[model samples]
Target: MPDAMKILLFLLTICLGSIIMQPSVAQTVVNKPSAATADTVTVRGRVTDAQTKQGLPGVTVLVKGTALGVSTDTNGFYKLVVPSIRAVLTFNSVGYATVERKLDAKATGARVVNVALHPDTKALQEVVVTGGSPSQALMGSVSGVQSQAAHDRKQKRGGVSVQIQGISSMPRAPWYGRSESYATIQENSFHTARKEPLSTFSIDVDAASYSNVRRFLNDGQRPPRDAVRIEEMINYFTYDYPQPAANEPFSVTTELATCPWNPKHQLLQVGLQGKKVETSNLPAANLVFLVDVSGSMSGPDRLPLVQSALRLLVKVLRPQDRVSLVVYAGAAGVVLEPTPGTRRADILDAIDRLQAGGSTAGGEGLRLAYSTARKYFNKEGNNRVILATDGDFNVGEQSDAAMERLITEERESGVFLTVLGVGEGNLQDKKMELLADKGNGNYAYLDNLDEARRVLVRQFGGTLFTIAKDVKLQLEFNPARVQQYRLIGYENRALADEDFNNDRKDAGELGAGHTVTALYEIVPVGAPPVVDPLKYQANPAVAPASATADVMTVKLRYKEPQGSTSRLLERALRGTATPIVQASENLRFAAAVAQFGMLLRQSDYRGSATFETTAKLAEGARGKDAEGYRAEFVRLVKTAEAARRPTEDPESYGVR
Candidate 1:
């Protein structure tokens, strides 16, 4: 709390580069997208790995809603048209950066978009947007990745390969989390199409992965890859990314490494830290923790986790921080109001008074909490509403539309929202994501105490202080050097290529020290096209770039707190060699995780990803595999592969 202490903390953090620092500014944000400028041409391309050159299958290619799209073939190449579309495409894959590709569309008829998907050594996950179920997305002019027509055309060249994999994890019946089949159109076990013809392709994660993670969450059994599902990873556990004092290790720092279930596996080490407040810091705080103390949250891993996690948070609060506790059950009411953070005993008492019963009045609780937050309005402090729940808001204004409106309106008052998700069964993950995005806040899942510490106590800066908002990435391909590119993941967040610099567009969030990952698969230029090409755009080069296309630049825009306008920051993509060392711990861990995500999804692009390959990859780059994340990854691979055949075979994942 003192100046000297703060300076000492900064010095220490400088020494430990990974120690997320306390923000320089006192920032409680009502986040928004950065500004946008027109008059730029929208250039698009696909991204694929440099290795296989396949369309890193199941990648996401969106340009915000302007009907512009880019998807790669089995060979990874994308196509799109746009004007002044600054950084048109945001290429994302699990464990890779949510990269923005901006290029000159003309001088290059077909640009070669090649990017090597990095591994996330820090276990960070790239955000995923799951739309209103594919069954409902029937009317848009979508890029066909799974349509029968597209399949037919491809089938004309290849064969259909379909396989439905199931698992038996429960040791009992029902086999609840068993199937990994996502409606693939396969022929004689060879090649085929994804279910949703027009929309994005869905990769069925290996059911065994889900079961493994589930076992960990439900029983702390520590199954392989048992701690995944970004939503759950962020929600189920609470990691304290507490405010770093003047001299304390910024926020709390924790790391772990352990040998996996695999006898040949080495170890997994995990490293974590809190956030740094960069500029214009504030002091007095007003936090409203809106918890769903409903019957639904009474599970072993649900309400209990919330209680324990919140208690930890209470421990980290400074005396200046204020807290409010609101519970939503049969009805919503404030259990505690504007209590000083220093009143630890009293706050814990209030938390203890919570009991699960009655129906959930999520709407009423939300409104009451918002009112209370605004009532004590700490214009100079953090004014936020943290919601903890299993998401079964069956009472009051339970409709999705109503909740969305409530959150959106609350966001207008600069009262940011943070949703802490818990437990399975009736989980409204999609709804939670929408609320967080609309409310200009972030979301996480709390599966256990360690997770709580990791999020709340350990890495608080990235969770709370938002640096660049509405950061949209578009990469223009130099067709002269590349042939095609396909973006990985982020299928639901795709934007119309032209929407790249559109100020009005809403985009993704970036937390302090938080790393986002995405991967692209690309084909080099001069490679013969697998399909016939139409001689369009003759004399493609009409004019030279307007001085902007020297190197692909990452364009970012964000509104200042309480300001109607937005500012911009542009960074040109430079440096030829990928800094394997300076790369954040997020890269390696995330890369491994992405590979795991792909394997679970049973992607066709994953050639030779036998158990041995997965184990070796995880074993090789398992950065700080803390809490055994890498070890767990290896275990899951083995479990999945063994689940395929009986006596511990390495070729299947629940085929038995």
Candidate 2:
């Protein structure tokens, strides 16, 4: 063997080793960590509307030329860790122009960079008009069409002038896609306590309406009239009610005061506070996550938010809990089989892998979820199907009646439902509310990640565990003390007098740590009669008990979460009416919320209620708000007030 040849081979091997050891160009471009890499710098700031100067939530902030990104919180605040001080950050959000900010290359330590984004008028102007004639197209471009037939008729009138006139006369589309639907709510009217002595209704704990209204107000749009469920809005905020007694499931508190909106009338606030149970003491849970990955849910606020939300839930799950993931798009299928919550990583990984596309088969998804829950039914534990969707059921039994029937049947299996509605424009709120009510569960609307955290993390026990079911309230107003009374809100929850005592009748459920409230506007015997004295019938005689100081008798019926038979609870409220200024924070806050709802709904009985009055009331009643939710509510009232004012420059008003 020649020594020269061996030496040459050795040199070639050394060259190959050197080449392999050197980092690739792509890795260097991506700023891969290395011994010489600079320490990470923390970047934090807020994104705001340029005109309104208000925080812009749900904005996406990203490191330029990299995959690293984070969304702003509810207040448009974001914090990100960058590999180097020289990194450039980009801010993007719906309806707003994108922005880019570059950090100082020589700067060290944490950096703060606030950004303001302007509304994108071009993006706002974009609309979809399908299968329309040239004249109809012109009309659509001028003023959005309400229906095809109406536009066609306007087109037949002929001439550009006529077409323009018709366009001006045409009504604007309720929404671009016109897909959102809300149940029509007829405001409760005053009823003479003499003729109708009993007021009965199912207790409601659902707060979807409040968040949904916030979404609309934040976008600088007035929510639809039907979307304002006064009862839900009133109950969205938690009241500082005392805990139940050791032997009871909940505590009842009642306050009577002069109505804020009407000094002539009295306001009666009835609150029930459920016992708070520690998470450690909660029963083991068998949860089926029924996620909608339909095309409509492809928006950032939909499927992606749902994924993030479920991830938060998974982090809090215990070893005794079991989780299953089921997703629906064009079809429904199980993505992950029943697995113990101890395997958090596995559940999270499955959730991360979810992507959105295809039509929504919500009905099929519900059916599949319930079946999966039944298959692994936890007899002694909590069994629930958590459905997260936009509630657009386009395929396979989409009717509300059909969905009610399906949920009603499945609820008999002892598996409760939790419907989390997300997204906008095409949100079928009516359907989701109905499904939740029929399934003997609660409904919530998640508008942002902060809300997701609040629902799945902050209020874990209350959101997932039920303490009472079939809860109903009945009040008998003393004819002698009261002439007419109106039940505020609860229009849809009103139950027939007989239904209150009927055990077979389904009603609202109370979650652990939940608080339910109801309000009544009463007219004293001396107040002007709401109705003319009966034309043909004589006034009924008041009972002997009605002569007492008691103004009304309150009765409640509820059943144990797992029990079929119901138990009765009763209390009496005396005729003493406190001044509005001296009312309890609970009563004042609730009255404020009720007034807010009435103003939003433009209720016939709103009286002197205004946005200013509502905000003032809320501001005074926001006592020791630990979560800052009460503060947020005050801001929302201001936003609503600003939105209601006429403005020439919509952009200045922050119209999204």
Candidate 2 to truth, TM: 0.81
Q: What's model 1's lDDT at 441?
A: 73
Q: Judged by lDDT, which candidate is best?
A: 2
Give candidate 1's TM-score: 0.56
Task: Single out the weakest 10-residue window by summed lDDT for candidate 2.
Answer: 159-168
TM-score of each: 0.56, 0.81
Encode model 1's per-residue lDDT on 1-656: one tens digit a residue. 99999999998878777435533333423233233333444344446543323234334454442223444432334554443334455554332334555565344344455554433222222112123322212211112112223224323434221111111233211123432111122211111111111111111111122333533323212232212342222222223333545542223222212112222111211122323564234345688999998888765456656876787678778777889999889989989978997788788767755667789888898899889999998877667888898778888776668888888777777777777877655666556655776776776755444455556665555555554345454545444332344444444445566666576666554455554433333333233432344477342322322322322233434554344455654434322222323333443344345445555545554444455665665556655433434444554454454342112332222233
- Best of the candidates, TM-score: 2
